[model samples]
Target: MSAPNVTKSNLNFTELPFNVSDSNMSVTESLLYDDEAQEFDNEEKTWMFGAPLLLVFGTISNILIIIVLMRKKFRKSSWGLYLTTLAVCDTLLLYMFSLDSWLQIVFKVWISDETVAGCKVYRFVSYFLVHFVAWILVAVSCERIVFIYFPMKAKIVCRRRTACIVLGSIAFILTGVNAHIFWTFSLTEYDGFYYCDLVDNIAELMGPQFVIIFLWLDLSIASLVPFILMITCNITIIARLIQSDRQRRAATSDGAQKSSTTSIAIMLVSTATMFLILTLPVAICMVLSLNDEFTSTGNNMDNLYFAKRIAEFVQQINSVLNFWLYCLTGKAFRTELKAMLCCGRFSRTPGVSNAYVTRSTSATTQVEHKPKDVKTNGQDNTVKKAQDDTKL
Candidate 1:
């Protein structure tokens, strides 16, 4: 039987778990009736089994990232600051959301239900971190574009101090924008289990239509605008990197330079592409699900729920995947990680230096300098001699 339309006063429908259907019976009644069945559906079972494992590993990975980025060699780079901040944000996102989800699914307990103040803190922190992370990515993309297009000016424009200031401003502005959540969320108890939900009083005062409008506005700020910014900046950065590669090839015959540039370009482009791929679905689903018309259709509700759960899963994946992306694609990061893991023993080993020299010599042989033909054999011989000496 189709569930009855439970009173909206008892729970905020939007805050309910995606799998939870709107039924005539209250949330408490539904839970009691389905206690055994609620053990978890296939999707939820997967999340429960896998998410905690990822969370634990992700937490360690982010901590390692933070530690590596804080080192003297990396801390001076503008990208390091953004990456460190991103790691911090990812860590927070996991603890606040992924851990909370595990608890809710396994124990049927909501951390935000502990106290009124806890509700406010949970809602505010969750929303704030979501926006903060998005904007930080936008900042990273913009910084990369500048570093690629204006290498000389980037030293001045993308300083560590500048990154700090930008991050601070982002935190301040986003916190101000999302501060409303602190007051808008409250604990609602049903059948002795408390759920964190939107305050009914505010909903009534604001009206349903107005609330929908506000949600659209929030969605725009939190996802749409940042997504656009990230895509635009990264696209431009990629274009510039390609152009720079061509110019560098024409100007120099250094194979090491080419390899370095290509690796960095791949890293930046891949990171931006991954962000767009993982986040865009969630943004689209959020926008569609927030629309009253879309949710009103009975047949579409199940599809919507599936989409929402998939979106949530992908979003959490995004938070934990950055460390792997960097480690896989970044040569310097791998070196640093190796050193850190070995407690500097790997770095101190003589083989590391010998390997560097071998690679450098090999790289020189791989790329030959193209020279204009000279009428004088002497001049040609002189240039050839110089090239030979430089290679040696």
Candidate 2:
């Protein structure tokens, strides 16, 4: 393939792959732009293979969450409503920004004409949803923290109506932020492919410094704040659980207190574990992006690209995995999942184990057996009866 003529108005490129042969070229389309040189074979293989997996897992898991929550019996809780909405948002993002873009990368084709409108829509959807996912996770963490620390207040504070309003408000704000992307870039045909790039008019106005600042600002809000909040909330939850266990041990040597404390601890630990596992890879990616070496356009580009992809893969896996944590730690979720899988045959009272149920039932029967005369005698008879029962 011969080099395209360098017009003064066009952006210069040093080289492209030889396979970009003479094809039906359009003057109105901009050169297909990649931030780094095309390592199509590697990039294609990764995104092509990984994307479908994300789509399958993300779709199935999120749908299951919606299904379980929408069941008539489980529809009342605010947390259930919030989780369902978050799953829906994640499902949309996975399909649009992740699955669709990745397929395009694999096919080596742009989805549409690289017009300003197309650019804006793509950037807006991608950027806004990316931030939206982070914020939604933050909301989830807050939900969990509130439930753990202030169960009574959480019931009142995070009701279904309020959750719906919060989620809607988040979507609106993010949509507005991303709407600007449409006005900035224009389509140009260069070489043999079409793409949208910054119009010279707009690029000159913002300058490189402003662009860098914007990128960092974007990173701070989407990544940094959410990461900090998740870590802090998870840590606090863990601390609360530990303190609860200590108090339970000191106050009650009884099995019921121990059992309840253990249940709460398990739930907190499992939630924290999922969050840490999912977030660690992303935090590492963010740190790597800051290093000048990792930000370079050549080999570093391939490394950083794949590194970010790995982070995203982990995040997608996280979405599916959290439900499992709920399954493992939550008696309610486990009962519900079992009931769903096995129909009504598996349906049972939540948190009823044979041994614990027997014990609790026996205790209740004992309480119901007090004599009529015991009440008339009051404190002396109560003490005497307790001593006689202990002797027996």
Candidate 3:
């Protein structure tokens, strides 16, 4: 297929894989840019294959994450607050962004474009949820910073109440930041279908700067700032972990402090690592696309667009990733999930069996009468603990 002689003036931003409202194409460009013969096999396969898998698996997995994080043990921890909110946000994002995009691309049925309010609301919610997903992980990292560096203060500082306050404040500010989309996205009917785009006098409403700043600002928030912050925070976290490990090795006793903080640190690092790996490619693609919009002829438009679409498919996969990521990296998450599935019965040790053993021993020792053979001393307790371990 021959490439179209397209330019930014004639380009339809809405005609990406997700929102191919081709009616937005102008007559001059339409004459050169024949959509009937061109096919995006790779792009189509990407959305087709990714959308369902993400919807089904991602939705279920995020629910499992919510359930696991919401357990009583996590209720008081800031980790629970941040992670649970993230799960909820990811769930909404998968449905709103991934599902809607899939439906529009594959079925040519988009409810959002059917009405003006639907269009604006959909735009607002989808963008808002995306900002939430990225920033919530930042919040998680912040929580870990408190836990690992300020352990003494972590209990007081990283509580559920503080997490809730921080998240709520962020949510409120992000809502205001993205609220412009709700006002700017108006449905314009061309031929028979509606296209979501800025209003006709968008310049008057948002000023000439809207065109200059809107997409770039979005890129900054959704990708740039986050990339820098997560990288810096995680590097600090890695350095701190290295220092702690050195101290632990030099000491004769096991580092109780290290043990307590290690689980959350592992979780934070894994989450941040996967988040960067999955999200950065798309961010790069977006940068390319935005740059190409001004610099390219229609020749490589398809290629640049295809790259972004593929990146988006990966982003969808990220939405459903928490469950698998957690199960792989988090012992407590796996233990809780197993417990939830099996009605308080844990599938392994290091969780339920250890707790059960401790409880049973305590009950025996606290009976109305003490056994003459039992000695209430630290040495005997150590011996008894060893015996219990040997029995297990």
TM-score winner among the candidates?
A: 3
Note the Cα lDDT for every prediction shown.
Answer: 0.67, 0.58, 0.68
User: Could you estimate the TM-score for every candidate?
Assistant: 0.76, 0.70, 0.78
**Error of model 2, residue 197, in angstroms:** 4.6
Instruction: Output the worst ten-in-a-row residue range by lDDT, candidate 2.
Output: 1-10
Off by over 4 Å in 2: 1-43, 112-116, 185-192, 196-199, 205-208, 249-276, 279-287, 290-297, 350-392
Better of 2 and 3 by TM-score: 3
Per residue, candidate 2 scores C-alpha lDDT tens digits across 74-146 of 5665656766776776787677645654756555445434456775566566667667767766776676676
RMSD of 2: 11.3
By TM-score, how accurate is candidate 2? 0.70
Judged by whole-model lDDT over C-alpha atoms, candidate 3 comes out at: 0.68
Query: Distance (Å) between predicted and true CA of 190, model 3?
Result: 3.9
Candidate ordering by TM-score (highest first): 3, 1, 2
Q: List the residue pairs that clash in candidate 1.
A: 3-24, 4-23, 4-24
**lDDT ranking from best to worst?**
3, 1, 2
Once fitted onto the true fold, the runs of candidate 1 whose alpha carbons sit more than 4 angstroms away are 1-40, 189-193, 254-256, 259-265, 345-392
Question: Residue 189 in model 3: shift from native, Å?
Answer: 3.4
